[model samples]
Target: MDEAIIVDAEFVAPVGTTAGEFVPIDRAPAAGLLLLVAFVVLYAKVISKLGKPAIQEFLWEIITRIVPSKQLRRRKEAQLRAIEVHTQRSNTSSQDQFAKWAKLDREYGKLKVEIEDINNSLTASKARFFTIISSAIFLSTTGMKMFLRIKHRKAAIFWLPKNAFPYPIEYILSFSSAPLGSVSVSAWLMICDAAMDLIVTIFVALVVGVIGMLRSNKVKPKTA
Candidate 1:
């Protein structure tokens, strides 16, 4: 009877391995990983720092640009005038006229209230959306950092304070312990590199096109 040999069974069933195996770390890859960690921290910081202001400004700009303020004022003034007219009529008119004006006054009041409520609700929704998105980004980064710390035993380089910590102390301690150089250096380099590449590519493309256009014009014979 021939025995079947299992090849790389340990690899296939790594969980079954009793003792841990040592894997060599390469500096290049390690540096790259650190760089990635730095990028995540910096990107999150940049977004969180700028995102709120940018979104707020953009929302206000949209409201200002698309909503006709003049029209809104005109409508409000007209509604006010209608209420005033009905009030004056109700004061001196017959019972039937008074009843009709009273109904109109109530309806206009409700309508104005509803309009204000709707505007308030819309404003609240915009703020909620901004909060939710920003929170999601922040929580996601914090979760990732937490996971890395637990699984890889990596030190916390950059991370949000844990919810378990007390407020002001948490803020002070977490920030004080942050590895700012590790977090920011690689991130800035990556950002600068990307920006420079984009600029150079655009400049080169424009120059090439202009040169081609000039050459074509020079070579073309003038029409009589």
Candidate 2:
């Protein structure tokens, strides 16, 4: 029992380290781990977003399939009644039929406008949600990359370009007992990189918004 316990103790290494004495796995800091997780989750989310149309279509099919027979019959009957009424109106005197059709056309135009407004509102809501998610993802990646630079004295996954005129960014320190300390030149570079990322994200979002506005204007329905 003692020998078994001793052997098990040898295998149990510190958290984030190699299990055995001979085997060495570099212990990644919490910041690095966070960055890795953030990248993975974000990548998966983007993929899911790309596939949303297909998923929605599949769900719609299932809903249609599972609709109650009585409800389906009622819908079919309503469609037939609408067709009958339209046919009756069409068979009336030519002038009367034309007047009726004009009224119906105006009503249809109004309904279409209402539907378009609803769709635009829904799209705006979705855009806001996407913006929030994207901002959170970007901030996490940038902040963690900077934290790793300060903690590990290593080159982060992303870094900023050297300044035209070099400045002393090293020697900055944190008085608080934080996991990320030892601020140096590299840390400042990481901070600069994060700022650049924020600017780029905002610019890209603005460009996208402009493109969306142009597209909507181009495709807007002409009023009769």
Q: Give candidate 2's whole-model lDDT.
A: 0.48
How far off is model 2, as Cα RMSD?
A: 13.8
Worst 10 residues of 1 by lDDT: 178-187
Give the alpha carbon lDDT tens digit for every residue of 1-224 in model 1: 12322234322323433334433222122455456555655555554444556756666568756876654565567567657756665674556677866776676676677567656765676677667766666666666555544453423333332255456644443333333222223333344445555555666578669999999999999999
Q: For every model shown, what is its TM-score relative to the native structure?
A: 0.37, 0.31
- Please write out the lDDT profile of model 2 over residues 1-224, one tens digit for every residue: 22222224323444444334435322334455445535544443443443545544454456557865444455456455556655655665647578877765555555455555655664665566556655655555555545544564543332223232233322232212222223333443444454455555666578669999999999999999
Badly placed stretches (over 4 Å) of model 1 are 1-25, 51-104, 154-224
RMSD to native, candidate 1 = 15.9
Best candidate according to TM-score: 1
Instruction: List candidate 2 stretches off by more than 4 Å.
Output: 1-94, 151-224
